[model samples]
Target: DVKVTQSSRYLVKRTGEKVFLECVQDMDHENMFWYRQDPGLGLRLIYFSYDVKMKEKGDIPEGYSVSREKKERFSLILESASTNQTSMYLCASSSPTLLSNQPQHFGDGTRLSIL
Candidate 1:
């Protein structure tokens, strides 16, 4: 089974502090993604890495960035945490070839709260 590990199950931060969320996958999958889910907006993509040492900005990448220095790990950095940025952050991993359904398995999610 593919396993994805997230750095935190819950997080609290000030309105302008930086935050780092880490994710690791044991499957050595080539695709990793970061998404922030909100009550009404659903899931919004923040970033993704399709291969080692490669990263791409997703639809909502304004305050986020990603790093994939190794095949099995991906990290997300929030430049500054804001009240509006408080949401459920999910990390997912998928095979390099799986595109149908975008069938990526996810972590339990990190619930972040910015005060």
Candidate 2:
């Protein structure tokens, strides 16, 4: 079975603060992604990494960055947190195969609140 674990289920931070969200996958997947979910916008990809130490910006990458120093771990960093960045953050992992339609396994998500 595949499993993606998020460091936090809920988080609270103040404006202008730096935040780190961590995720770990046990399936040894070749691809990992970070996404923020909002009421109307749905899931917006922030970043994704296909290999260790390699990252690519996704749909919404402003004010956020990602690090994948190790194969099993991926971290999302919010350089300067703001109220508008408050949302549910999700981590997902997928196997890199010829079939691009493979489903990504996701974490339970971290509900973040900025004040």
Q: After superposition, how far is residue 111 of candidate 1 from its true place, in Å?
A: 0.2
Q: Could you tell me how far off, in angstroms, the CA of residue 80 lies in candidate 1 after the best superposition? A: 1.6
Where is model 1 poorest over a 10-residue stretch in terms of lDDT?
A: 94-103
* Candidate 1 lDDT, 1-115, residue by residue in tens: 8889998999999988988999999987899999999989899899998899999888999988788999888999888878888899999999877465657999999999999
Instruction: Give the count of colliding residue pairs in each prediction.
Output: 0, 0
Number of backbone clashes in candidate 1: 0
lDDT tens string, model 2, 70-94?
Answer: 9999999999999999999999999
- lDDT comparing candidate 2 with the true structure: 0.96
Model 2 Cα RMSD, Å?
1.0
Which number leads on TM-score? 2
